[model samples]
Target: MRIAYRVETVRAAEQELIARLPDGALMQRAAAGLAAATAGMLGRVYGARVVVLAGSGDNGGDALYAGARLARRGAGVSAVLLAPDRAHPDGLAAFLRAGGRVADDPYDVLAAADLVLDGITGIGGHGGLRPDAVPVARAARGSNALVVAVDLPSGIEADSGEVLGEALHADATVTFGAYKPGLLVDPAHAYTGAVRLVDIGLEPHLPSVPDCEALQHADVAQLLPVPTGESDKYRRGVVGIVAGSARYPGAAVLAVAGALHGGAGAVRYVGPAADDVIARFPETLVSAGPPAKAGRVQAWVVGPGLGDAPGVEEVLAADVPVLVDADGLRGLDPAVVRDRAAPTLLTPHAGEAAALLGVSRAEVESARLRSVRELADRYGATVLLKGSTTLVADPGGRAPVRVNPTGTSWLATAGSGDVLSGLAGSLLAAGLTARDAGSVAAYLHGLSARHAANGAPLTASSVASSLTNAWRDVYA
Candidate 1:
């Protein structure tokens, strides 16, 4: 699992490490890492033109010292001190001694630079860039040089992942100590192209738990249930799906398609689309009326294409874990969900999430991390906020929010969410917690989309079909 800590936690860890180390030791370590990473990116550092955007903080000192190292290796490095007066005296002297020059015109140096280091602002910066620095940052962006941010890009809320205003977009970000929440979540994540973590000996002092986490293939493999010789259909667990209406039968078929490949031994589908679902997937145990009468199921998935049909209440009333999606999320009451004894998973896209929170879709998109966390706490249910970067946040905010890293935009097709809804519900039936189920489902679903698409546009059915390969990929 890849974990991300908040800025304050990282700061605390850095302080602890710095206290025990020699004076300037911590900063030197950071500078060395930065220089090495920058060198690797440049490939041939000798005679390469490198421009460092230095500010009035330690972040700037790291860049300056890194520039000094590059200069020593025969790179033509120059510093554009955004705050010349407040720049690190020691770092400045080192750069000067190493044959680095301070640029007379920032634009002139930025224009010809092969690489640009954005050290104007660090993780602590808020409310965007200073007025004086905006033009220079914009120029850096407009330049042909590869932009690499120091620690984090300027103007993003490290904890919340919110972009306050105009921010510098980096081709890559070299974050030290640990990963910040902003580096993983979107809005800020979009600004960061590729992120590289440089260890500065801070993890030993940091907390065991992180603010955010993303499951890798190995982690998901451990959570996935495997059957034994004694396992039967019932023993392996059955997932009940309450989806599709007369208006939309494909939703039910796609949902069942995903469930069959979701590692659940059996799938019991209860909806008006029974005939349509049976026609496609005969293995599905189809039923009518409420989900409670759909025989015994370990978990229930309700909502996709429900279209004002009545099943959300029936499924929620069941003692088993329930996952609500699509139409099931329409005008959902918090009190009802909060009062349920069993774990409830609510899967909502940005628009639906906005409606549930009484906020605009734009607000939800802009601050996805905060919105997902708030929704989970408000409904007292686990929330799977579906987007480019899928996030699964459990109720009460105790656990780290799991971010799904695998995905392609091709998964944005119409019935894709329906497939995801069933996949997650099946995992729930297989005995995974709401958080685990959601995150694992998302990971597989995204990998399936990638496999199915393969650079071409894929349909929901194709994604469902690719699940077998995706599951195998995890094991491999």
Candidate 2:
């Protein structure tokens, strides 16, 4: 798992590490890593044109020190001092000693630079770039140089991942000590093109639980359900899907498509579109009656393309893990969902999430982390907020929220969410926790879409068909 901590946690950990080390030792360690990463990016340090955007804080110091190291290695280094007077005394002195001079014109140096190091702001910064630094940031981006950010890209909220205003877009970012929450999430994640972590002996001082985490392939493989010699269809787990309607029978087919590939022994579908589902997957057990009358199921996926069907209440009343999605989310009674005995996972896109939170769609999209957390807390259920950056938040809010790393724009297709609901519900039946099930589902769903698309326009059914390939690739 790739873990990320909040700014406060990172700062506390940094402080603890700083206390034990020599005064300049910690900064030097960070600077050394930064310089090494910069050198690697440049391919050769000698005769390279490097520009450092230096501000008033330790971020600037790291950049300045790294620039000095490059200067000593025969690189033509120039520092654009945003706060010339308040720059790190030792860092500036070293840079000057190494033949690195302050830029008389920032834009001129930036336009011809081979690489640009952004250090105008750090995790402590708020809102956006300072007025005086805006033009320089723009110039650096407008240049042909490969922009690299130190610790974090300037003008992004370190904790919330909000891009309040103009933010530097880095080709790559080298973060020190621990990964910040912003580096892992979006819209801030979009600014940080690629992220590399530099260990500065802060892990031992950091807390065990991070604020956010992204699961890697091996992690997902371990969580996936596997069959044994003693396992039967029922023992393997049965997922009951309550979805589709007379008007939208395709939803049932798509949901069943995903559920069948989710390691479930059997998929029992209960809805008005039973004929459509059965036609597509003859293996599916179909029931047109209420969900209570459906055969025994370990978990239930309710509400995909369900237009005012009576099964919502019936499924909710079932004593099984329930997943609510799509049209089923409309007019949902918070108290009923909150008071349920079984585990509940609510999968909502931005629009649906907005309805649940009584906020606008724009509000939910702009602040995805906050929106997901609030929905989880308010509904007292695990929430999978779907969008560019899918997030799974638990009701307790103590655990680190799971952020999905694998996703493509092709996943925005219609009926994609329906497939996800079924897939996640199956995982729940397979005995993964709500958090694990939701996150794993998202990971597979996104990966499947990418595979199916392969640079072409993808349909929801294609994504669903690609789930088997996705599952195999994870273990491979």
Candidate 3:
């Protein structure tokens, strides 16, 4: 698993690491890594034109020192000092000795540079760029140079991943010490193109638990359910899906498609679209009554296209784990969901989440991490915030939130969420916690969409059909 720490935790760890090393040792280690990464991006750095956007702090010191190294290698390196008087004295002297010159005009140097190092801000930076440095940042962005941000893209909240105002968009970001939460999430994640972590010996100083984590293939593979020789259809677990209606029978079919491949022994579907579901997936156990009368089930997935379905209350009243999505989320009583003893997982897009929280959609989108955590706290349920980045948050807010890294824009198609609900519910039935079910479902759902689309437009059914391939790929 890839983990990310908050800015405060990273700073504490950096302090511990710096104290153990000799004077200027940590800075030299960081600058060497930065210089090497910049050199690799330039391929032949011997005669490349490099420009460093240096600010007032240690972040600026890092850029200046890296620029000095590049200058010594025969590269024409220029430093655009945003805070000239307060620049790092030792770093500036080294840069001058290595044949690096101060830029007469930021825009002119940026326009002709082959590579730009964005050291304008660090993890301590709060809001957007300073007024005096705005034009230089803009010029670097507008230029043809391969923009590389040091540590993080300037103007982003390093801890929250919130881009308050104008932020630098880098083609690549070379972060030092450890990965920050901002680099792993959006809208800051969107500004950070490709991220590469440069370890500066801060691992032993960091806490065991991180603020957020992204699971890899091995982690998901271990979490997936595997049937033993003693396991039977009933022993493996049954997932009951309460979805669809007379008007939208396709929702039931898509949900069943996802559930059939979700490692569950049997899928019991209860809805008005029994005929449509049976026609598509003949293996499904169909029932038209409420979920209480649908026989025994380990978990329940409620409300996909359930328009005015009378079973929502009955399912919510059931003792089994429940996953609520789509139309079922409308007018959902937080008190009722929080009172449940069994695990509950809620999957909502930005609009649904906004409506549930009584906030604007833009608010949820801008601060996704905050929105997910808030929803989890209010509902007392695991919330899977679905959008460009899928986040799974625990209700108690003790564990780190999970950020899904595998996703394609093609998942925005119709009926995609219905499939996800079924898959997650199946996992819950297979004995994973609400947090694991939601996060693993998101990971598989995104990967399946990418496999199905292959850079083309794909329907929700295609994504569902590719789940088996996605599962196999994860294992492989």
Per-candidate clash tally: 0, 0, 0
Q: Return the TM-score for candidate 1, rounded to 2 decimals.
A: 0.99
Q: Write the residue-wise lDDT of candidate 2 on 432-459 in tens digits.
A: 8899999999999999999999988899
What is the per-residue lDDT of model 3 for residues 350-421, given as tens digits with 9 covering 90 to 100? Answer: 999999999999999999999999999999999999999999999777899999999899899999999999
Candidate 1 runs further than 4 Å off:
none
lDDT of 3 at 421: 91
Lowest lDDT block of 10, candidate 3: 309-318
CA error at residue 172 for candidate 1, angstroms: 0.8
- Per-candidate local distance difference test: 0.93, 0.92, 0.93
Query: By lDDT, who's the top model here?
Result: 1
TM-score of each: 0.99, 0.99, 0.98
Q: How many backbone clashes does candidate 1 have?
A: 0
